[model samples]
Target: MDEMAHKYAHILVAVDGSDGAEVALNKAIESVKHSQGATLDILRVLDLNSLEYGGAGIALDGERIYKIEQANEDYMLKLKERLLKDNEIEHDALRVHLRFGNPKIVILDFQKEYQNDLIIVGSTGKNFIERLVVGSVASYIIRNANCDVLMARTAVNKSK
Candidate 1:
């Protein structure tokens, strides 16, 4: 970031392995470039509440939970590595969080801890039925965040 202009010093991006998320990340990177030294937080939430463990009453086994958590950590590590290799972001400028909970609530609550000035999320990852039933994460974040929010859509490729 330039010394005097930093419209968004900190940005929070939520991803869910969707095409929209990929675009959102791309947009976040683009925004960070203009903001200069803005730090980014990438959050991925696993919906453990919907897990099927022998019906509904049975608890999810400890070992299974452990493995899932490990997988999430591995994915985060790979993401960090990819970002460091591809972007202008320094290793310390990017932070990844893999949390298990309702995405809407987790994302909303997470930004409070980071003092983020901007929040970027995919426009809609879920289909019509799912979104109708549970509501979309992007909609929730846009409505609830205390800071500026962006509902990122598909990427637009520019040619020279």
Candidate 2:
């Protein structure tokens, strides 16, 4: 007899070009492979507003923002191509989304629009101080997201 398989129709994974996010992406890819007819949605959220600066009013440098978006898009496109080539899956099975907003809020809010049954994220993408100041995205999701959340991690501290 074979054990029952859990088939997830829709899966969402957030990536930020970090080691933790890399692990999460790998897990998401594996999940899409095993679950027949499942679709993997990879999202990378950029906060251009955070780059804005002004003495009194909000100021955004269009040139800088454009450069960042262009670079980010290139990165996402390369990842998408590699995933398609390495996985041997249909092109439509994998979807890439780039949005501008607060990652912590936008990630969970995304489920409302796309209705992802499963959300996978890195254990801690931000550094120690950043996590302290802005808080961990994974922790926020675990507390707020109604759907199932998985924290993918790596043995980066195994040496100690």
Candidate 3:
């Protein structure tokens, strides 16, 4: 790959609150900052189905459910703020989106919707092992997505 050529025009970055996601996001921002032609879209998919059946024994209070939804939204906003404020990634070059569904589908749909030049996703997400046993979201995206993809090793999260 010609890393120096900088051919990508529009980049779609998929973040799943993983530490690896931070790396992917940073990489995308750096690409946009360098390539005047590139614009970055940050996508966070909340797998509502996973949340519902994720085996968290604690029964959800109705307000808690709403809070979880709100938290997801807040996380997206914070991603924008972190990029714009901390990294100085240009506002004009950035956009943030939140989707509720299967991450693999959401990513592909976003790629089609935005016609992204490239997609940057973490190799390991919240459901990495599950992905391994069945299939990884990243793998699914790579197999089905039309655009180029960048898959990092592991996310850098507080848990790790």
Candidate 4:
């Protein structure tokens, strides 16, 4: 057990089903494993802005929304299983949460509620043009989060 890992009693990780996120998740699991009694919170925020709009500028229909929500839930479940299988951490030490809204906002709110000592998030490595149009959630979190932020840089981003 390293001293750095023991510094955080509560760790919050934001996962968006991306490879970078998987890296961050793995780091969070390792930190929790090394830190006795530390808990890990896995948060998946469904970015409403990514959803398709209807003819009148309204959001997708209820049925479509329901299906998307169900799919996201299933993905989270599978993610949890993978985390457990890949690591030796106890199931009770991990907590999973799903929310519908802007990811940056939801993550900030969760951090406030949980009072996490550390926040682990994956860098998406979006190009300048894409970031200008869509905005970068990781950038926003790094600037706004109250706790320590760990940006996991994926191998793909390292080559660039």
Among the numbered candidates, top TM-score falls to 4
Per-prediction tally of clashes? 2, 0, 5, 0
TM-score of each: 0.87, 0.85, 0.81, 0.88
RMSD for all candidates, in order, please: 3.3, 3.6, 3.9, 2.8
Runs with alpha carbons beyond 4 Å of true place in candidate 2: 1-5, 49-59, 156-160
The window of 10 residues in a row where model 4 has the poorest summed lDDT is 151-160
lDDT of candidate model 1 versus the reference: 0.84
Model 4 TM-score (2 dp): 0.88
Candidate 1 lDDT over 1-160, as tens digits, reads 3531367888989888888898888888777766666788999898888778788887888898998889889998899898878888777778899988998898888899888888988878678999999998898888889998887787567442
Which tens-of-lDDT digit does each residue in 1-160 have in candidate 3?
Answer: 3472278989999887677787788778877887766789999888755675447775666796688779988988887887788775668889999887898888899899999989887666547568667687877888888978887665335464
Ranked candidates (lDDT, high to low) = 4, 2, 1, 3
Model 2 poorest ten-residue lDDT run: 1-10
TM-score of 3: 0.81
Off by over 4 Å in 3: 1-5, 52-65, 125-129, 154-160
- Judge candidate 3 against the unseen true structure and give its global Cα lDDT, from 0 to 1: 0.79
lDDT of each: 0.84, 0.84, 0.79, 0.87
